[model samples]
Target: MALRMKVTYLDGREEVVTILPPIFMAAEKHFKRDGGLSERNKVASTYYMTWQALQKFGREENDFDAFLELIEEIEDAEDEAEDPTGPAPQPDESSS
Candidate 1:
C-alpha cells in the first residue's frame, strides 16, 4: 500500500497527500542523513520534505525555501474518513 503524509501548514491547513515515488525520493535522500538526528540535520530534512510536498501538490516550482518556513509539521497520514479508535465493547444483556 502507498504511504500518505499529513502536512500541517503554519496557516492551519492540513492536507493528506500520497507519498508517491518521485515525491518520496527528494525527502528520503536527505532523510537518510548519517548524523543521527542532529539538530541541524533535523531542520534540513524537514526543509526537504516540505519543499518536495509543495512542489508535488502545491503551485510552487522553484526553490521553496520560503515555503518551508510556512510549514508547522509533517507526519504519516491517518485515515480521517474512518474511526481509528474503533467501537466500544457491548455488554451481555441475555443474562436478564
Candidate 2:
C-alpha cells in the first residue's frame, strides 16, 4: 500500500504525494541503523524521505535522480537543527 504525505512548500503551496509504504519503512530502518538520528528525529526523517520520494517520482522521469539529493537535504537540515555542527544540505534545484 501507498502512504500519502501533505507537503507544504516554502512558497506557501501545498500538495499531497503518494509513496509506497515499504520504501518509507526501509528509509526508517536505515535512519535507525545509522544512529545519527534521535528517536523523534528518526520518525520525522522517514516521513520527510517518504514525502520527497513521492514528490520526485510523481513528477517527470528526469526527477528520479534528484530524489536522493532531496532526501539528503532534508536529513542534513534535521541534523543541523538538532546539532549546530551539522550544516543543512541544500536541496537540488532541479528537483525543487
Candidate 3:
C-alpha cells in the first residue's frame, strides 16, 4: 500500500507525495530493527525513504539537511495521524 502524506519543508513549503510500498517497508524494517529506532538510523531511513519516494514522483531533493528536516516533519505528522485518541463522534445529519 502506498502512503500518501503531506510533507512540510524547512522553508515552509508543502508537498503531497505518495510513498511506494517498497520504500515504506524498508523504512519500517529499519525503524523497527534490533536497536529499536536509533537517531542515526531513523535519520538515515527517513532520508533514503523520502529520496526514493520523491524520485518515484519525478522530484529531486539535493539538500541533505533539508531532506532530513522534511522527513522528520513527515514522521511527526504520521504519528499525529495515528494517534489513538479515540474516534470522533459522527453527527446525526440524517434528519437534515
Q: All predictions: root-mean-square deviation over Cα?
A: 7.7, 14.7, 8.2
**In candidate 2, which residue pairs clash?**
none
The TM-score that candidate 1 achieves is: 0.51
After superposing candidate 1 on the true structure, give the runs of residues whose Cα lies further than 4 Å from its correct spot.
Answer: 28-47, 59-62, 81-96
List TM-scores for all candidates, in order: 0.51, 0.40, 0.46
lDDT of 2 by residue, 1-96 (tens): 555555444445444455566566666575775664367676556555555565566642324344434332222232122233667788889976
Give all candidates' CA lDDT scores: 0.64, 0.51, 0.63
Q: Relative to the unseen true structure, what is the C-alpha lDDT of residue 32 in candidate 3, on a scale of 0 to 100?
A: 76
lDDT of 3 by residue, 1-96 (tens): 655666666777766566778877766776675564367676566556766677667775556555675543664344334435668889999979
Candidate 1 lDDT by residue in tens digits, 1-96: 345667788899866666566655666665555643356676666556656765777744667677667778877665654345768778989987
| Number of the top TM-score candidate | 1
Residue pairs with backbone atoms closer than 3 Å in model 1 (clashes): none
Residue 84 alpha-carbon offset, candidate 3, angstroms: 31
List of clashing residue pairs for candidate 3: none
Residue ranges of candidate 2 with Cα displaced over 4 Å: 34-39, 60-96
Q: Lowest lDDT 10-mer window, candidate 3? A: 75-84
